[model samples]
Target: MLVTTPHQDHSATDLPRTGPATEPAAELALLRGDFEVHLTVGAEAADALAAWAEEHGVKFVHILLARGSAASQPMLTLRASGSYTEVLAETRRTARRLAADGFTVLRAKVESVPWAEGVPASDADAARFGAARYFEHHVKLLVPEGAATDGLAELAVRHAAHLSRNARRVRPDGVREQFVTQRCRLVGSETAAARLDALLADLTAAGHQVASAEREFVALDSDETLDAGWIDEVAAVAKVAAVSTAA
Candidate 1:
């Protein structure tokens, strides 16, 4: 089951106070309690590392590598799967193992961006793809490069929720299954309503076949479900709620 606990912001305590001039050879840090591990690797090596991590029961959380016109060896990021708390525990175990495997832990900054908009689609395939909900949480992470937007994976992780959906239908291999869904909290009566309104506006503008909408939710085109990239676009409009106006 997905672990549910308040994500403690221990980045200051969890991360190093300073960094070197250049990025470290390899490092891992927990962002908002979720383990975000970064390491440099070549393009081919990156693919291999992903497979290896998965084979060892490590779920891919998010990844960010160097960007350029030409493809070359790049850094590999390993993340723990599940809620912030769940991932945190797994990360601790995985971090030690990764260190033994020649990886070092570095200070990373994590920021939890509030998600104010989310739209569910009506298509059955979208449901299967788990495009039913959107989630947001407080973020915390270490920025080695000082807040430069480097890669899509980094941006995606920093500003989005870990959407969970069912994999392709398959016969059970005598293993029990648990499906998890991620959700975001709306701060107040008016703010929640405003956010939902913005969500519906974006979906309709993006040519999504909107099915319905409400004060805090909406239904959109799910048949040709847009990936997380599209959802990111929708969420981009959601601004952080003002502290004084929060419920």
Candidate 2:
């Protein structure tokens, strides 16, 4: 993946400067590409949906189902592949089964399909395929604000501490087959560079190689060959990375 440098300051007319720009930038990134599935359920419905998805080979990146306002009511939000036609077919199958079993289909909506950053529809196919490999699963963890005045410095200290203690025990929550792990790395924005440097220093102290560094991201390597342990460590690193990057 091509690492992006810290953005140049925006002109006064271009964007508001009352707060941090990164928040809005992240929001826009989310808007650029996403797919959503909406469904409502009664008791035992979520289990049925999971079973149906498994039986039909319907893979998704994230599947979130929550209890609604009343007892025995549930709602699901699923994000999956970008292919609309194929996804619709899968949804239909699920709906048919649910309907036959006397469940209610509240609303089915296909939100935005994933699209290339700057590619026009005419060239979307080639652009999508070329850019698809760059997609990585990012998990963000919030840094708590304590009684310290220097939030950034405190963030660094806590991050380094977390890495030392817990950067190797986080296990994946059964999403492994749907999402693949690639070259796991640490990353930060310019605002968080000092904290990043501190964390990277801790990583090096632990004997992991600093594989690469650019303004947007940093890469780290394990002494042992990459395996499930590395995957767990990456999850731990992700927690630290997220807190550091969070404003």
Candidate 3:
């Protein structure tokens, strides 16, 4: 016989970040691209969910009774890390398996955090560095309005040799599956923010009608963990650039 309990209403003030006591070590070690799997189950099936996780080698990072619009429901959030492809595949398989086991699977969502080598001094620093690295290393260029694309392309070509000289290839874990190709994709734009600044400056100097610049972020790769905080310091300047562009 299957046993189930009615959904209860949890007071808004009673909800904790991770429910019960917090686990500092596990929370701190979480990296970008780590999977956040949310599973909703019947109120009385918490034990069954725990058993299923144990049998499947999945670790439950947090379990909480979340208040829904109408009622409170038991929710499980788990953390899993691996290559993008691997994590996605495993999440799908787990959801399918759970549904087949006579449990009501409400929803499963995956959220990715940017990877950092070590914990930031604070959350503010993390956001600063995260934005910087995103713009500098991940982004290729920011071409402002009416900027000479031909001139920029020519500049990139001319600086290709010099940029290649300073380029550094990152191959973490001795695996070629993920690597960063850091090359001189542009001249004058040595840093992430500098690239945008230079592009806008050049256009203004040349008397071009500059309204704003176009932006492009780097493509996603399997090696996000490599050099996770490489551009934190440089990104400080980028933070300013982002604001300036928006203004």
| Model 2, C-alpha of 235: deviation from truth (Å) | 34
* Model 1 lDDT tens row, 40-116: 33344545555655666544333321322222323333443333333434333443444456544342222122221
Leading candidate by lDDT = 3
Regions of candidate 2 where Cα sits further than 4 Å from its true position? 1-36, 60-94, 114-247
Where is the poorest 10-residue window by lDDT in model 2?
Answer: 217-226
Better of 2 and 3 by TM-score: 3
True-vs-predicted CA distance for residue 125, candidate 1, Å: 37
**Clashes per candidate, residues 3 or more apart or on different chains:** 15, 0, 5
In angstroms, the error of model 1 at 28 is: 22
Rank ordering of all candidates by lDDT, starting from the highest? 3, 2, 1
TM, every model = 0.30, 0.27, 0.30
What's the lDDT for candidate 3?
A: 0.36
Candidate 3: regions farther than 4 A off? 1-32, 61-67, 83-85, 116-247
The TM-score between candidate 2 and the true structure equals 0.27
What is the lDDT of every predicted structure here? 0.31, 0.33, 0.36
Model 3 over residues 1-247: C-alpha lDDT tens digits? 0121233332222112222221212332332344445555555666787677676666432222111231223445556654333443454455555666766654444334433223233444345323222322211232343433455333322211101110122344332211111221221122434555554454456544443332322212212222232212334345545778999
